[model samples]
Target chain A: MKFGVIVFPGSNCDHDAYHVISKHVGQPVEFIWHKETDLSGYDAVIVPGGFSYGDYLRCGALAKFSPVMAAVKEFAAQGKFVFGICNGFQILCEAGLLPGALIRNKNLHFICKHVNLKVENSNTPYTSEIAEGEVLSIPIAHAEGNYVCDDETFHQLEENGQIVFRYCDENGEVTDEANPNGARSNIAGICNQDRNVLGMMPHPERACEVLLGSDDGRNIFRSLTKAIAAHG
Target chain B: MKAKVYVTLKPSVLDPQGKAIHHSVELLGFEKIADIRQGKYFEIALDATLSDAEARETAEKIAKDVLANPVIEDYRVEISN
Candidate 1:
């Protein structure tokens, strides 16, 4: 499936996401500028990580107003796939594609490290290839990854099975120590109600190669390919 | 006209940056402080032709829609000529 990577002015990981899709995933991908308002040609759209608009006002706050975001909202409404990583996840949250907001890290420091994430709902399109309760090591780099939401919304997310991944220990145990950024209930990733959109704090693109530390993230792409092929 | 906006996190949500600053303040020997919460301030310029009520309304709308995420923040708008 063809993928389009959304590139805002300060997006640095757009190239990384493009490289992973083309070189590793062997899929055709293109960079779509934030100002462009079209996304009809792509089967999937990826919002890659970076400090869009220099993180002014708040992270991803300024980025939600970019013209492309309107197109993205339309694309997702049509049930098209949308994947967001790290800052991309923040953008999606700010754009209201997903519930909850990422706040400052509990320690008030920028954290960069590899953390284990347990696949919470493997039946979804993004995690179909991953087994439930399986842990994948992925690196996360950010200062505002602390996810928060009101009690009612949190219950809705839980009851609807919208949560896709959660921080866990090596043994696949969900614990406070494994929560690198103090995300609520150790959440690392989540999908929209329709399951067509996903936003995660971990950088799966950066973990697609064994040479770079882990290749476990490749399963996410493989899962998408399988799902699209089987249903499309 | 100038619009001054103040955005702050909701009381229920945690504010790690503000908490860190509070701890630092305590380290500096300041005690008896109840709590601390951090927020953002913005100054927006509007056309002079707009009336006071119109400017306040515009400022409130922007402050609600753009300057803050209502889900997690509370914003106050003050207009000055």
Candidate 2:
């Protein structure tokens, strides 16, 4: 299973994502530049986290227009898996490949720390290995991670079970509404209507190893591997 | 020609930054504070040769396609006459 990690300008997590997938997980992986328009050979693509384009206009605003996004969009349309982590999520949303937008932290301050996210829906291939309601501790570093959407869309998300993850307490209870990021309904991650694409604020790749203090995120990658194999 | 794009969160959408600012304003003892909502402003300069309808179409298309998420936000374009 070959994985292609897309690296945009100011993408600091390209190497980190590559390290976890290729070195740690033993999945063949390669780097795809932001300018690259071809993604035909790879089975999956990952938009790693970082302040792309120096986060000049907005978190992922400028990076959305990169040449690679055009291909990413095309690939996603063909039923391929695309993972967007943190700032990568912002870019996906900005590019209209996903819904909602990442706003500034509710408190208007940069938030960096480990957070517990409860798996809401595991029916998707990305979370198939994760049991529903299971809590996974992952690290989040961002100033704009607040997810916002209209009431109708919010209702639709709930109705369709598209809400994938939410911030929660240590005991696996979702709480602390007045938290740092100010994400709506405590949402930390979500998926598109088809559930093929995933965009989350937390870094699962960072938690795939014990050296990172937890292996809770390994299941996500493993699940992807299983799903791809099954698809074959 | 100069154009301004106004992007705002759709109705019934939560605006945490705006809410926080409203709270701060209230805390500062602003008795007349009613409400607040955050939005984005863009100033675009385009070629003068384009017709008003062309420019408006361009702005609206981008807004609907990219600059704003129609599911959660709405945008309006204002062009200089």
Candidate 3:
């Protein structure tokens, strides 16, 4: 299956996602510019991490209005897979494609390090290859990676099994110290109610290579292709 | 016409920046201050043709839809001129 990586101004990780999808995943991938309004030929779209629009107004706030986002929204509405990583997750939340908002880190500092995450739900297309409760080491880098939602939204997410991943210790235990960003309920990633749109603050592209530290993230890309094949 | 919009974090949301500011205020010997909250301020210039009521409505719309995220922030719009 082919994948498209959306490139916005100040998007530094678009190339990284493109490279991983093309080389490692052995999939045809293209870079979709923010101004482009077409996403007709791709099976999945990846909104990679970076400071889009210099993170003006707020992180992902300005980028949410980009021309490409309209197309991305349309793509998701069609049940096509859409994966948002890091700042891309923030953008998705800002665009209202996903629930909740990412606020400033509780420590008020930019955190850049690898953290352990437990796969909470593996039924979605993105995490199908990952076993439930499996710990994956993924790197997170952002000043506003704290995920927050109102009590009602949180309850809905919980009831729908939309919470896909949670921050956890190496032994797969959820703990406050393991929550690098102070996200509510230690949530690190979540999918929309339909389970087609996934947003996560951790950088999966950065963790796909074994030499880089962990190859655990490869399961996500592999699972995406598998899901596409099944759908076809 | 000119309008001013003020955007602030919702009361239920945590504000780390505001907390830091409160701590700094205490460090400066302002012991009487109980809390501090940070917010965004924007000055918008509107078309001169619009009447006062129209400008106010436009400013409020902008403040609610663009300047502030209703999920995490509350906003108020005031016509400046």
Candidate 4:
């Protein structure tokens, strides 16, 4: 199976994702430029982290209108895997592939550190290999990582098992203190109702190697690859 | 004609930057402040061929779709010479 990593104008982590997918996930991957509109050959698409459109107007607002985003939207509608990390997560939300919006961090700080995340749901393809309640040490670096939505939408996400990962402590306890950003309900990641599109603030691409700090991030990619291969 | 747009966060969304500014003002001895919120302002120049009503409609559409995210913000449009 082939994987595609999208490269926006300001995307700095495109190569990182490409390397991880090739070396760690043992998959063939290519860097897809922002202007590219075709995605038929790739089994999954990854939107790597970085400030797209220089994060103008809002974090992901401008990038949502990019030419490739229209294709990404249609890809998600076909139940293909689309994973967005950090700014990519913001872009997915802005593009309406996912629900809610990411706002400025509550403390108004560009926090960069390794935070623990509890797997809230493992049924989705992104987290199928991870056991529910498993805590992953993943790094998050962003100034606007706070996620917010209205009450009704929040309820539907809750009722649909769409919540995939939640900020938590070492022992897997969800708490405000563990929430690096003031995201409602300590949400760290979520999937669409169909569970095909997944967005998270954590940079899994940066944590794919033990030399870097943790290899826990590999589980997410591993899960996706395994699920895709099994389906074929 | 010139169209002005005002965009502000909805009351339900927290404005951390505005809060920090409020705290700074309190430290500056401005004791009468109840609260503070931050917002954005934009000005658009429209072609004269469009009527005033048409300008309003165009400005409102821009404000709704491009200038503001209705999920967490409210926008107002004003038209003038």
Candidate 5:
């Protein structure tokens, strides 16, 4: 499967994402700039985490209007697979590609550490390799990783099984201890109504290598590759 | 024209930052204060001669897309004509 990782000026994780998709998933990967509008050649698109635009106008505010996001919206509308991690999640929310918004860390400080996330629903392409309620250790680093949504959207997400992951402990026990950053409902990730677009605050790429102390995140990228190949 | 947009978290949402600030206020001896909730304000300068409808549209767009996250925050725009 051909993958494309979008690189905004402040994107600090594009290379990490590309490395994971290419080396770990063993898929063809490309880097697309924030100003570019063409995305016809890729099977999947990823928006990696970073303080885009210095987090000045909110995390992903100014970055959402970048030219590349216009194409991303079109691609996402076509049901192409899209993943947004960390500030990428913020960007998706800013672009209206996702249902919820990422707010300041309830603690108001930059949190940088590993977190355990439970796979709430493993039916999607992103989490297909994992069993329901399985836990994966991944790192989260952000000041505005709090996820919030109105009752209507929140209810719809719950009803449609849109939530994919939530903060938990190694035993799959929900806890605020390993959460690092406080998010509503201990949410670590979620998808759009269509489930084609996913936005999560955790950095899976950071955990894809065993040298990083955990390879649990490799499954997510691998699952995407498998799903695309099977569908193709 | 210049307008100030106040972005505040919804009542149901938890504000850890505001809570911390409240604690600090009490420590600093403002004992009579019942509560403290924090908010952000942005003073936007629009170059155009904006009509009421246009101004409202801009503010709404910003509130929905930027200045505030509609998921957790309710925003108000005060315009200076």
Candidate 6:
């Protein structure tokens, strides 16, 4: 499947995502600039992490109004896959593709570290290869990854099985200490109601190589490939 | 005309920066303060031809739709002569 990685100005991880898709996942991928509004040719879109728009007025706030976001919204509405990581996650939420807003880290600091994430739901396209309740080590870097939404929306996400991943310890135990940013319910990732769109704080692309740290993130890409094949 | 917008986190939402500031203030011996909540302020200059009411309306709309995120924050707009 052909993948498109959206690149907004100040996006540092765009190349990393591109490398993971083309080199690691062995898929054809291209960079789609934020000014370009067309996404019809791509089967899937990956919004990589970075300080888009210099994180002005709040992270991902200004980037939401970029021309490409409108096209990205349309792409996802067609039931195509859209994966957003870190700042990309913030952008998705700002674009209303996903629920909740990412606020300042609870500690008021930019946290950069490898954290364990437990798969809460493995049935979606993004997490299909991951076993339920399995823990994967993923690196997260952000100062505003604290996810928050109203009680009603939070409940809706839970009831819909949209909460795909949660912060957890190495032993797969969810606890306060495991929550790196104090995200609501220790949520590390979630998908939309249709499960076609996913937004997560952890950077899976950063963990795709064993030499860098862990190759646990390759499972997500593998899952996506499998899901796309089945989708056809 | 000039318009000022104040955007603040909703009461139910947590404000980590504000919390840190509150703790610092307490440490500085200002123990009587009840709480602290950080927010953003924006001053916008509108077209000079617009009337005060028109500027106020425009500012209000901008505050609601653009300057503030309704999901986690509230905003108010004030127009000045």
Clashes of each: 0, 0, 0, 0, 0, 0
Q: Is candidate 1 or candidate 4 better by lDDT?
A: 4
lDDT of 1 by residue, B1-81 (tens): 999999999999898888888999999999898899999999999999999999999999999888899879999988999
Could you tell me which residue pairs clash in candidate 3? Answer: none
Clashing residue pairs in candidate 2 are: none
Greater DockQ among 1 and 2 belongs to: 1
lDDT, candidate 6, A157-198, per-residue tens: 999999999999999999999999989999999999999999
- Model 1: residues with Cα > 4 Å off, grouped in runs: none
For A1-232, candidate 1 gives per-residue lDDT tens digits of: 7899999989989998999889988988999999999898788999999999999988899999999999999999999999999999999999999999999998878999999999999989899998999999999999999999998989999999999999999999999988888889998999999998999999999999999999999999889878767756
lDDT of 5: 0.87
Q: Can you write out model 2's per-residue Cα lDDT over A111-210, one digit (the tens) per residue?
A: 8788899999989888999999998988899999989887777898899888998999877787875245888889999898888788999998888888
* DockQ each: 0.84, 0.49, 0.84, 0.80, 0.60, 0.87
Better of 2 and 3 by lDDT: 3
Tens-digit lDDT track of model 5 for A152-185: 8888888888999999988999887866666767
The positional error of residue A104 in candidate 4, measured at the CA in angstroms, is 0.6
Compared with the true structure, what per-residue lDDT tens digits does model 4 show for residues A116-228? 99999999999999999999999999999999999999999999999999999999999999998899999999999999899999998899888999988999999999877
Where model 2 places Cα greater than 4 Å from the true spot, the runs are A177-180, B19-31, B62-66
What lDDT is reached at residue B52 by model 5?
A: 68
> How far is A179's C-alpha from truth in model 6 (Å)?
1.0
lDDT of 6 at A8: 95
Supply the TM-score for candidate 4: 0.98
Proportion of native contacts found in each model?
0.79, 0.63, 0.63, 0.58, 0.68, 0.79
How big is the RMSD of model 5? 2.1
Q: How much RMSD separates candidate 6 from the native structure?
A: 0.9
